[model samples]
Target: MTITIVGVGLLGGSFALAVREKYPKATFVGVDASPVHGQLALAKGIVDQMKPLDEAVAVSTLVVLATPVNTILDLLPRVLDHLPEGATVTDLGSTKGLICQLADAHPKRAQFVAVHPMAGTENSGPGAAFRELLPGKNLIICDREKSRPDSLKLVEALFSDIGMKLFYMNPQEHDLHLAYVSHLSHISSFALGLTVLEKEKDEQAIFDMASTGFSSTVRLAKSSPQMWAPIFDQNRTNVSQALGDYIEFLKQFKVLIDEQNLKDSSEFMARANQIRRVLEGIDRK
Candidate 1:
């Protein structure tokens, strides 16, 4: 099979590596906006060749759009335009609502599947990619009924082959839940990083005094702003609501601290500890 991956960065390159492992005979063609990334993808053997979007899509049996959410919105329709009769297209964008909505209006809507692989790290670029990234990860496929049976099955099988668990959701539910569980964490990390950086002023002092807890908490702040900014924009409403809820708790906690209410602060932390059970359950799965 001929697969064309656009973007060819971490997610795209990692996915290509996993696919090649499962289907050793399958060929890969890369289409990336960055010349450096394209070259790195080639050197890493993530793809068999590099091609322009039009040329890549023309020869592809499957096209994986691993670009940013905003870029996916622009590319999906154009890919479908060039897709072969039996070809299937899928995206690995973080947000699904806007991308899925855009696909719904396309004439070849059935040819596309809107997927968000619940995986990735703060890293970017093709050099950071590895075949192991997708294994044991959950993948969400939104608006599944809108896709052609062949297209959906092909996508599901490919993900399954790479050891990913699949789940289904409407676009709205996916975005809403992700806002709290995923997006909000990044927002918090970014905010925490910024707060510390602004207050500390000395980078050397931060590194010298940093604990593992602080490093872990602020890690997402290292994530690419270019990729995350578009996601925040695409899912602004849900993200905004999530942020408001988070801020309310922060305010309540601040009040407890200000009043020196040890009992209330302890109770608040105890209540938050319930999240440990939820996280443990996921770990067991």
Candidate 2:
């Protein structure tokens, strides 16, 4: 099989590397809107060749879109329009409802498989990619019934080869859970970075006193603003609702601290501590 990967940044580049590791016999081609990225991906051996978008689509057996959320939405229909007959196209976008809707009645609709691999680091660019990122990760395959069985099975096999655990969910549910677990976390990280940077006013003080916890929480702040701004904007309703709920929780905790309601605060913390156990379970899987 020949796989052409579009937008060779963190996600796309990493995916290319993953495919190379798991499907070494398969031909690989990388395409990116950024000429530099295409060159870098080639230089770094992420793909066998870098080709123009349309030509790549024409020849590829599978085409993966790993562009930013907004760009992915715009690119999907164009890719669908150009894809070879029976070619499979999949996306690695975080949010999915809009993309699913856009591809709903596409002529190659059966070839479209909507996927979000629940994996990433607070990094971007071809250089940031590594093959280990996808393994053992939970991948949500949204609305699989829309895809042809062969196309869906092919996608599933690819993810399985990379050691991914598959889960199925409708796009609407995926977006809602993602808003709380993924989108809201990024917002919290960005806001926390701004809050600390604004108050500290001294870079050295932040550098000297910051703990690992602080570093971990704010790491997502380093992510590309261009990629993330549109994601937050596109999923504004869901993200905003999650953010409001997060703020309310914070406010309640603040009030508890102010009132010296130590017992109540302890109970709240005990409940939240279940997250560590849940994460432990995931790791065990």
TM-score of each: 0.99, 0.97
Which regions in candidate 1 have their CA more than 4 angstroms from the true location?
none
Clash pairs (backbone) in predicted model 2: none
Candidate 2 lDDT by residue in tens digits, 207-272: 999999999899998778888898888778899999999999999999999999999999999989
In model 1, the worst 10-residue window by lDDT is 276-285
lDDT of candidate 1 over 1-285, digit per residue (tens) = 999999999899999999899999999999999898999999999999999999999999899999888899889999999999999999999999999889999899999998989888999989989999998899999999999999999999999999999999999999999999999999999999999999999999999999999999999999999899999999999999999999999999999999999999999999999999999977875
lDDT of each: 0.95, 0.91
Candidate 1 Cα RMSD (Å): 0.8
The parts of candidate 2 lying over 4 Å away from their true place are none
RMSD of 2: 1.2
TM-score for predicted model 2 compared with the true structure: 0.97
